[model samples]
Target: MYRFTGSWLHKALVRLCASLLAILGLKLSAFYFLGLLIVLGLHREQLLG
Candidate 1:
């Protein structure tokens, strides 16, 4: 019974960590893309005006 519970807890912990990492990765990528877009816009304005 203890072993079964331990295994279950381990699985849950792994799943939690994986989900957290996935969320972090998504947020980082989104921020990076947004920054790139803003930089491009600024560069275009500088070139045009």
Candidate 2:
């Protein structure tokens, strides 16, 4: 029983870590895309001006 509990705990921790990493990766990608969009917009305005 103790061994089973330990295995469960290990699996839970791994799942938690994986979820956190996926969320962080998505957030970083979103921020990067947003920054690129802003820079592109600014350049477009400058070109028009």
Candidate 3:
């Protein structure tokens, strides 16, 4: 397991990476969004620390 630490820059990079991945490949886009769903919603605690 991993936790996203640091600051707002990390958050921006995550969003940037999400958009970039979505634009780069179809398969990656699917997996990235699903992971985003799991991280952003299902496992909110991971980001709070």
lDDT of 3 by residue, 1-49 (tens): 1454455668999999998887878877789999998778756776665
lDDT of 2 by residue, 1-49 (tens): 9999999999999999999999999999999999999999999999999
Candidate 3 clashing pairs, residues 3+ apart or interchain = none
For model 1 the TM-score comes to 0.96
Error of 3 at 32 (Å): 19
Worst 10 residues of 1 by lDDT: 1-10
Reference-based TM-score, model 3: 0.37
Per-residue alpha-carbon lDDT of model 1 for 2-48, expressed as tens digits? 99999999999999999999999999999999999999999999999
Model 1 residue pairs with clashes: none
By TM-score, the better pick of 2 and 3 is: 2
TM-score of each: 0.96, 0.95, 0.37
Specify the poorest-scoring 10-residue window by lDDT in model 3: 1-10
